[model samples]
Target: MPSNDIAPAINETQPSFNLDDYKIIVEGSTSILTPKSEADVFYNPVQQFNRDLSVTCIKAWANLYLNPKQEGKEDIEEPELKKIKIEEKEYIKKFTILEALSATGLRAIRYSKEIPNISKIVANDLLPAAVDTIKRNIEYNKASTNVIPNLANCNAVMYTKEFDCIDLDPYGTVAPFIDAAIQSIKNGGLLLVTCTDLQVLAGQTYPEKCFALYGGSNLMGHDATHESALRLVLGLIKTTAAKYGKYVEPLLSLSIDFYVRVFVRVHNKPIKVKDNMSEQMIGYMCHDCDSIVNQYLGKREERTSKKGKPYIKYGLSKAPTSSTECKVCKSGVQHLVGPMYGGAIHNKDFIKEVLRINKEEHEDNIYKTRKRIEGMLTLAYNELPDTPFYFSPSKLSSILKISVPSLKYIVAGLGSLGYECSLSHAQPSVLKTNADWNTIWYVMKEYVRMKEPNYKVEKLNENATGYRIMTNEDIKLNDSTKSISFEPNDMSYKIEKLRKLKMVRYQENPTRNWGPKAKPN
Candidate 1:
């Protein structure tokens, strides 16, 4: 409803014109007027005309269809077509796609025309008139002549094909069609879905109401609402897939201004599929504060000793101790549901393969495609390494033979690079204060030794607590004020040099309130 200055002006000759509410123009001597609410010209005019006269709509449609890339056009047709072409080449010959809720079929028409060797595409819709229009569009475009058209509601369409890829762009949340959509996909198949009800998904408006429609949890605060909606959708998909002996691996998920789109890969292998649904129950989240606790229902047994008596415990029959208390009303526990899906987006090899295919086929735009593929692959790869704080920082420092303060800097650096890490105080002071020191130190040392042979280290002191390793003088911390200052001597210069190499970081004790005092790196 926000004013769009670029939309075409209405045809003045037509007396019932409302420029603000509709867009009208002439295509090959035929009047093509579309109501603002209904962007598709095919569906708006079909009911008014009989089958014999409906051909008029098709004739007018041709000009708009083929010339979408004309000067100053605001339509989605051409861009979507280009994207399909890119995806097709990247996926290769075995790809199977289903437009689960096709209305007038413009998207399907564009896909068939643009993508080459797209093995199969099923265009479906619930209405008879829409189906008829789709058929007409297919014939008019002369696209994949073999494209199949199905007449069924979105849910029923899922029963027709076990597709390798499925696209769901319903008018609203697409919630009603999700279970069936998951069932329709083969293992490793791609699922692309769109949720257009921004108000509901974004959580600016009512939350419980949104949950009723979307069948998942809602978040209330900042931009997290969008992420919450995406996670909710992913959780629903995972739940549905689990019922049919499958698990969904999220490939790419994003939330734009007014929509949430997710691309996930389904896995149906016996091992990946959980035979006991109970085993899949992973955790419960506090609806009020977003606090999460772990639970396992899988068939794992353990023996426990209480007051000198040992007893065997069976699988996840009861809940574990609450991980966190509700931050809101400070009362009643939130509900638990789902063996929700979790993991990185794409496999590194799969992404590499996609990039190679794009490089060979789309030689002109290979750089652009490679960049996108690399970004996605990097994000997926980065998300998979368990959060940094999962390992004791002090223990990590011991393994890497680095000071705890230096380890903190490494942890903070990794965090700034978009890694997920947490700090814990449950372990000993030496073990608890370090970051992911071992991994960071190894990677840094490998890179540095390969790049700079001049840098060397010597052990100064060794004890039960920890050991001090000194590097050559000539390096310094980039942000000295944030780090501890060594005696401003050769040892200090060496420490600073190590900091520059990202081999260590300065850390401060969280419990000690020393009035913002700097710690050594």
Candidate 2:
């Protein structure tokens, strides 16, 4: 960390420069000066949502951990529920944040202005000109008191003191700094990580590179591929922390346009860290139907000791829970895909807190992406917490050669059968539901019967997925059977409920070239 004298030196040093020659970019409460079009890479307009979401998550975490009045879902008395069970002396009332890869110090300055009760902010970069620009901007924005600009290696963060929050938002993979952040963070500290190597992380093009970095196999060409990216990063973080007798509680994990961002809290609990064996899973994913079956490494069961106090006991799961072929659509092959993090990625209670904070604190003009944030977070809160992945209605329909059903119709069918359903924030077209493969296939078959009752089933090959489903006798399904009814008459209400939602669920491209910018010379 930078010394106390550095603050006075920064205040006294008059690096003569005029803000008039630079372009002023205002976002939230901080206005940064960047070199015109040439140096536009210094700031990315694509990450406005990233920054806006960060401010809200930090505030919620602070309220949950720093506030004397305990709030949120966790009970205060539970020893395991305590935010940071580190020694009391290590718990600071005010947060000390470090932005390791601060490009133009825009994000650091925003943190200084947006999040309350911050004792110091260290924005480090390797370029001298960048450091000078940070100092000039701090002076211009009147943020010198909290924002400390440093000229050193962005990863030279192995200092003696630990920070309350450590943000790593490098342009690419954060592999080099994962261990350093894991070791340097104070217990119960927040680590904000961004991986922009969407190609590698999503396993879209290079599955080998994905495995090399994340230690998990890649899942390419799937509806949940983006979420698979998020899980891969989380799995890496979880394994790294577990090695140091720690565990990660993911507050929020998002798969944005071209990157994956996660907000995780690292806590020191040797016993709980063992649960990762159970929390992580290997997935059997079907390429054709987009159906996924998770095979957990282990299982955690609640048991009682001799004295009758409840405790968590970790054990192995039954062998070969799934077969080699896709059970839902018998003709499709099941590929063994993952060693991904299988735990609840979002803490619903924390999401609720974030939503509340956004509504109460962040004004509309300052946080321009407020509505999208609300829509996304609301979808996350409603997601089935135990479900490992999601499937697309279109993919399911394509295999059965049936007319595509509206998203509302799919939701209604599943909801009517007592299965919970929600839209995925990662992919708008996918459905995150608790319905089993058998029920889901039945629903599709039922839809096919109602729509194309007299269609020539004999035309399909015997090995085709549609033909297999039409001949299956276990469910009493046949080519012309119409025995299935959509069980109660009340299912139509689900369609109306979804229709009433008037929220901005996804972002359309605002510019022709709206993605990661090239680094400036």
Q: Write model 1 residue lDDT over 318-358, tens digit each, in one string.
A: 65665444322232556553343233323444334433443
How high a TM-score does candidate 2 get?
0.89
Candidate 2 error regions (>4 Å): 1-9, 12-15, 71-92, 474-499
**Which consecutive 10 residues in model 2 have the weakest lDDT in total?**
73-82
Per-model C-alpha lDDT, please? 0.45, 0.78
Q: Per the 3 Å backbone cut-off, how many clashing residue pairs does candidate 2 have?
A: 0
Q: Tell me the spans in candidate 1 whose CA falls farther than 4 Å from its real position.
A: 1-95, 213-215, 275-314, 317-340, 351-521
lDDT, candidate 2, 1-521, per-residue tens: 32223233267456466766788888999888877665543788868999999999988887786554443533222232223334754433566788888888888999999987787888888888778778878877888888888887755653433677889998789888888788777778789999999889886678878888998875788878888899999999999999999889999998888889999998878888989999889888776566677888899899999999999988888786778777766745887877989989999878999999988888988998898898888778767787877888888777777677777676666665667776788877677777777677877776777767776778888888778776665543343523445543344464446536887667768688899887655
What is the alpha-carbon lDDT of model 2 when measured against the actual structure?
Answer: 0.78
